[model samples]
Target chain A: MFSASVGLSRNWEPFDAGEEIVINTLEKLEGEPKFFLLFPTIHFEKNNGFQKLLDGVFSQLNRSTPLLGCSVAGFINPKGCYTRGVTSLAIADPDMQVTIALGKNAKKTPQKAAEEFANMIKKEKSKNNSGVLFLILPGSTLPKDIFHRTRRISNPLLSSLFDKFFPLYLALSKEGVAKESEFIDKLYSRISEKMIGISAWDNNLGFSNYQFFGNRVLQNSAVGLYLSFSGEITIKYATPLKIFSEKLRVTKKDNSNYLINEINGLNAPDLFFKELKLEKKYLTEELLRKITLGFPISAYCGNIFFNRVIGLYSDKFLGLTTALNTPEIYISTASGSSIINSFDKVTDGGEKTNFVFGVSCAVLLEEVGSKIFEVKNILEKKQIKNFLFLFGGSEHFMTEVTPISSQESSVTTFF
Target chain B: MSEETMLSVLEDLLKEEDVLAIMLARKNEISVSPPPDKFKLKNPSIFSLLQSTMNEFFVVIEKFSSQGLDKIYFELGEYELMFFLIGGDTALVSIIPALANKGLLEVEMENARLKIRELIQKGV
Candidate 1:
């Protein structure tokens, strides 16, 4: 359905190093690209070179084609994974129509902003009637205004009191997460027919950095790229976490899954360590990544086991990526071997020999270390040509009219 | 009590052949039992889609009050969208395949609604 070429460059001395590779990517393409999707690493963000490099590429393209990209921790391509270079995927498909929309001021009303962006593109004409909407959302926190609006407690005093005790409540509230999810939901609901592509997260640049880009404008927004394809497309995703034999019941927890005092009738943190068999001194970033990305609570739904990634951990309580909240109980454990096995399982089949784009969990790179290269080798052996991968904080995919957030998982769509 | 009741109800819904997906949303936030992975409604927009559908349907319902229509039903190709207000900002949404027995589905939904009501009344 498409032809794509990828280019990478570690030289950032002249600020044109990345652009040189980008130009080479376009030259390598069989035909004129409809659009360009750039995934540049944090190294490009140094010395304010991200924008400079973006401008350089824009100047080279001369505004002839649409450019959309996000700042990523790292990226992967047909060759291998890269941490210090720019990975540009130039897609050339005459049968596919692409629309790029940026939702400005996403920090304020992420849901609404995203809806507007999706709506704008949906209003345009799609060639094939069958396409995919690939979303790139910001990883940073929503604006405080959105949080306050979410509270909706009405009584300022009551809300303040709740906030005083649970300071992170407003920030990590399930409601806040739901709002973002709802935004993606609404977008999909508006256009249910389009196969939703893997949604990538731009490394949270906090409030200062420009998180997303469309054309030449860098802004805090959700960028939705609508690609209408005339041919066939397939998608495969792997959460890469499995439940251990032992099951742990949540004996007690707050409204959010953050403050869990006990699990399986024992201290939460103690149970976590005992079940995983880890030493306290070895709780480094590497191990933490393995746990958060590899070990996820298993929840049974239909015939599949969906793994929920853990967000934070402390001596007192354990946190989860999303608030599974009250009445949700499950067992979870992390093993590098299990994660590697799960990756192999998920990547079993359904891959096409044509164009492919994937977004892998950035944290997984820190955890599995060398296994990532093995994964690349597997893909290479599979002979997946013209493929690009983005390593980021979170990966997004939509199915059945909703967007699902996954960690330690790689989402790849084949066209 | 509330969690168990809701979870059990959802589990029951899964047994139905036509129930492609079932989810519950409270104040626009989805609290689906068995999680999104099970029903495959993991799309973040599913809640908003249901919420918006209900919101728009209610507006139409309020406008056509004279017709005495107490329920809303809609279809999208092969999927049947149905929902019942389970009281207090909560709505149970079910996406069923068109081939399913609609009558039987309604009966199951009503029974589930009653259980949810009991939980609400008991403050569980």
Candidate 2:
């Protein structure tokens, strides 16, 4: 039998929060958990706090249990949405087996890291076992070297000029994300099977996000959990996007296909504005945020279309969060009602299961705000008693034909 | 407002760059802005293809009328075609370069569709 319990601690102190989470979880879990998943907010990472939190957790449970997780923007549980504190999911099953793997230097050498991560899992799992891969990696594309260099510019005038041309820096940062996508592609090619997970994120979209492997805190790395269960596993996903514009061809793009330079013989931004009937003069930071939240570019890949949220743009280019493999794309928008309604749609039609692991895009959580409680209500209506939902920067899932990385909400239920 | 005024409104859309042609079909009547000869020499088969496609599109519009479908867009060879339904029996079609300012053109077409709808409602 499969049993799962979620533990949440809102204590301000990191060590106390960790202890409370373990005590809270162990009180209801009945037995020693085989696997433990941690989803802590960035708040605990201050002043070596993550290590202290992990110490507290280890103080309570066996140090050998497979534990893997990452810092999140926030998370949702039956209790409600929380932006601060640590939440954990502990699972105990007699027929389920899990193996943990870690690949370092994900940003610098993605292909090598992917090989290490995949090779570890492949060597550990038995040949006849049907395994599911859960991955968490650093999601930020902000180039640390450039950012530190820019910070060292002491001249006021030079700093102001750099600020004025910030979009260029943003475009450069997007190249890292393109590399990460390539890394994911490599992982998919090596481990061609079911996969579902998210990328680590922080509250402010900063570079403070960290992944947890057992008692250690890691950055710029990929962590995986290979689970082979003898029972049924159901995966449900929802990304209700409405297509608004007709198909537009990508006439030109950067080498990585992450930075689009031209579309339909016009500058990427120019074509985007023209299609939306907006003027260039009215563009502002606020307007850009609204545009990114409302209108995301949807590119067709394999047999499905995946969304690529616009993260950076200038007069000459449009930087997307994910790589675009196809030349054809359509402008799409998501409404608040549609996002909320997706909860019901995703939770529906699946066999009734008590244990569920959900991952949603942090941007969507920020967009929906307090309306996220409706998701908890939907889960309650579906009779899901114990579940853990995390909000990360990006969500990943494997389609029938290929792997897809996009801004989506998904739930993986094990019965 | 008469058909001449409606045609003039569509002519304004041609002011934008790369807009090849505009066609307005109302029941048994048809109107093409900039005349057919201007672009007929450049691409002679465009008009015939538009005529045949519009007939089949009208049939589709009738079938999906209950769903309140108002717009249809598709790419044909090197050009893009956008068809907007004006009232029950009238359709406004614009043919433009594949890379034209589609967003701005959409707004312009909506304005033109509204103007033509008012004219048709007035028994022009």
Candidate 3:
């Protein structure tokens, strides 16, 4: 029957405003929360000031405290939203238990390590204690090459991505170049067949809710912990809805620059512009627009799969990623209904969990918008009190949102 | 030996029938005289070629010769390929493109071989 009430007061002080924001939060949480998680909203593009803010925040935290957090797209609180921000979840679960296990940087497998840790929980703890594992994997560790076959099929201009989006890029392959313009047109017709399909998802953050916690940029790689505990863990995720009317892919890229191309003949950033049908090119194409790489996660063929706008490329036709040939992207047409549904279908549950920790995508701040209040209202309907959420990449394979589960959430070991 | 034993041995070598299928080649003379239906690899010489490519063959030299290893792993560069040996002359080989974590799989195979040896020696 405990309540989570957040008070927000934005700071306008030009110098170290971020520090004030977190300091105020610490003061509010001073009365030792049954268990409090601290997540400082980090906006590094803001660079300079972020450092002092982090140092100050870190100084205040108990080094022994397990903080389940990440680099965010934005943050949320009662104060509304912004790209540069942070937030924390304070809990009071007298019956709760949690712990965090650090994975060997790039050496050991996250799953095996987490499972070993999960098994380490005291066998004497009434054998009925259920827990979750929350993983915060490093985003840079990804597999070598799944799309090596694509190198043989080339459009010359768009062959580089043959390494990642391999299965679908075969549409533009040529038996032998026949007619020039006609063949080019035929190529576009063929490209339409090359639809984006989700390959294996790496959400083995040890808990069931592997869907939450990373960015589209964080897709190829991952990190986090497995959360195991001693009972019933509660959790869910949410995202706004929109559908694509036009689509594009970046077939060729070099760093940020991409030679964007697509199956429909739409070139460069125009495909996104046309897909959204928004006239202002400046707003849609801007680098800092905080555009959510909206993806749809649905059940297909009895397995969970994600469909989304993978990432953004530069604003050049040759570097047309933002302009053209990026991988598959979805254009939002309408909003989703379950202001609470995205978070509804969680990873399959079995172990009993009395508490959980959540690390959410920074972008959820935008997608949830004012509706975050509505989502919170929905949560108020539940009795889940021990929980924490921080803004960062969706953490796994989600385009817009990711949440670490109790199994993946990091907390000091308490059986 | 027995057809049952041969089939079991062949199945052990092939792993799965999905992609790579190991087939036995019947020697010509044997086929004509006894309908031998024998088996040999099309490219046994590839092993010789590999040995020559490396300028030396690392044969029975063992970490513990008395213990006798049930398996040995070879790392072929360029391809980073791996091949394993089991039961003396019988060899389990794989090309990189068609292989997955051969070194790791070799450990499991060795464990299985050791157990089989134990069962045989124990009259089980």
Candidate 4:
């Protein structure tokens, strides 16, 4: 009852690429799709004309079909994770009931905005309880608003730090009563009992160019899409980081994601370098990658080790790719071999999936470097018919019960 | 790492017998020390509700301080909540029991803040 096609095209010309992708996708689909999900790389979004081009191509394809899109850091098609291009999935299913609500204004609390959007969907379609919903928002980070009232600092270094740290804080604050996760919890609390689904973070993928379009809403809004299927849908996440160090607690932290004031009782950067047995004097890009591979921060929930990666480092702090407010954290690491093993583990069950959607960490590609293609080839070998991978700075996949984000993992939704 | 030292400090502070729960907030977040499930607050939802409202308060305060504001206090019946702006965006929040000595708790909170600041200043 449900069928979809994945399309990807890399014409640097944004307008031409948009039309070409749509045409190629339509060729592969059996009939007109009721919904189309667009995922374009951050570079594609940087071209100011991309949005108009998207509107033109999307409307031309089918005015009746609703279009939902977000800027992505990177996206995946059958070919694997590509740094550039547009990747999309078109879905046409008569049994699925769909409803969408949008929340505008970047300054509003993400939690409140999501709640309003979810409430609207719930109010309109309270009768249907069997489907899933996808909450799509612009990528987590945005360029620091120098003009904003909160950021009036005049010093360029301080301004740059504030700009970078503020958005990262919003993205990485997951545990406790934090910004990003708080919004997620509020939204989830509103509709978790009635429906099942996940929230997708789309920004210029990893670039700060965050935008989302759906219904009457444009950029700077949280868009909630409600989907009810006559058939069943199963969802699960794949966490790839393996813990390598003993558990330690986050004793202190600053408001920004870039700086950890303290971990355990020692200064964070000191403890980080000390534990790795690496000298600060010899720090290099290769060493940084190796350290990132070996020392991801993992939070213990029940018995599971939920991991977060530190991609950026300075004398001040260790930058967390995934948000955390939990007091306890452990050192975690990922390797090319381990990631491949995780891919095999996730896909080995043979679920006879009609479609498998992958959301992977951009850090994995950074750490693995050119070896990403090897992992891609492994994914390609999967017996499952259709699989698309999306690579971003961070990846979030959630069900009603367990919602988490990771830097070295892949969360795949099987349909 | 330094978890032991900080936990010991928190342990010493909690030994005051009147401190029921201690929490930390950075920006719009509130994290209960000893974890919420273990320490158990009477109404956790109240903290979340207030956190959202306090965000507005922060927005207004930003207009006054280019460097950001430092420290705020609140009294609700028998409870006390102390908020300290540390490391710019981070807030060190502490909740004290009604029967505890307010003056003593404030001093302890300052001590913890100073130690945290020292750790940050001595970055690797």
- Write one digit per residue (lDDT tens) for candidate 1, span A1-415: 4577887765554258656866788888888888887776554555677777777677667576877777675665775655545678788888778787777655446567767886788678574467777777655333445332121223556534543454365344432232334355566656664333333333322112234464453544677678886665555667666666475678877654445668878877678777778775677543454454456666644443455555445555665544444344565555667655655555555254666677766555555543455666666667665677777656767544345665567776776
| Pairwise TM-score winner, candidates 1 and 2 | 2
Chain A vs. true chain A, TM-score per model, equals 0.79, 0.90, 0.47, 0.82
Give residue A181's lDDT in candidate 4 (0 to 100).
52
Model 3 misplaced regions, further than 4 Å: A1-36, A44-51, A78-83, A92-95, A104-128, A138-230, A237-305, A312-391, A395-415, B1-124
Clashing pairs in 2: A274-B103, A274-B104, A275-B103
Q: After superposition, how far is residue A40 of candidate 3 from its true place, in Å?
A: 3.1
lDDT (tens digit, per residue) of candidate 2 on A1-415: 6677899997667888888898898788856798888888887766798998898888887888888889987777877666667899888877778888888888667788899998998888766767677888777655555432111233556545544554465344423453558678888888876778788987634445788999999887899898887654566667767787899999988666777878988888888988899997887544566676578888666655568777656555777766677899998888878888877776675336666777877767766654566777787887777777788877887745677788744545444
Per-residue alpha-carbon lDDT of candidate 2 for residues B39-110, written as tens digits (9 for 90 to 100): 422575886777656666677777786689777788776678888887556788888765443533564476
DockQ each candidate and list the results: 0.01, 0.01, 0.01, 0.01
Residue-by-residue lDDT tens digits, candidate 1, B13-86 = 66454566776656545465556556644344654566556555545545654665434467765567776665
**Best of the two (1, 4) by lDDT:** 1
Q: Lowest lDDT 10-mer window, candidate 4 chain A?
A: A196-205
Candidate 3 per-residue lDDT over residues A1-415, each given as its tens digit: 2223232222222134434544555565534433333333322323343344444444654444444433433333444333323455444344544443332211123333333333332322233455443444332112224222111122433444543443233223221111111211222232211110011111111011111121112221223333334343443333334344434444444332223344255554455555555543455322223342333211111122222222323233322111122255444422434423443333112112333333444333334443444433333345433333344433332211221111111111111
Interface RMSD of 4: 23.7
List where candidate 4 sits over 4 angstroms from the true fold.
Answer: A79-81, A106-108, A142-179, A193-207, A215-220, A255-259, A289-294, A311-316, B1-124
- What is the descending TM-score order? 2, 4, 1, 3
lDDT of each: 0.60, 0.73, 0.32, 0.59
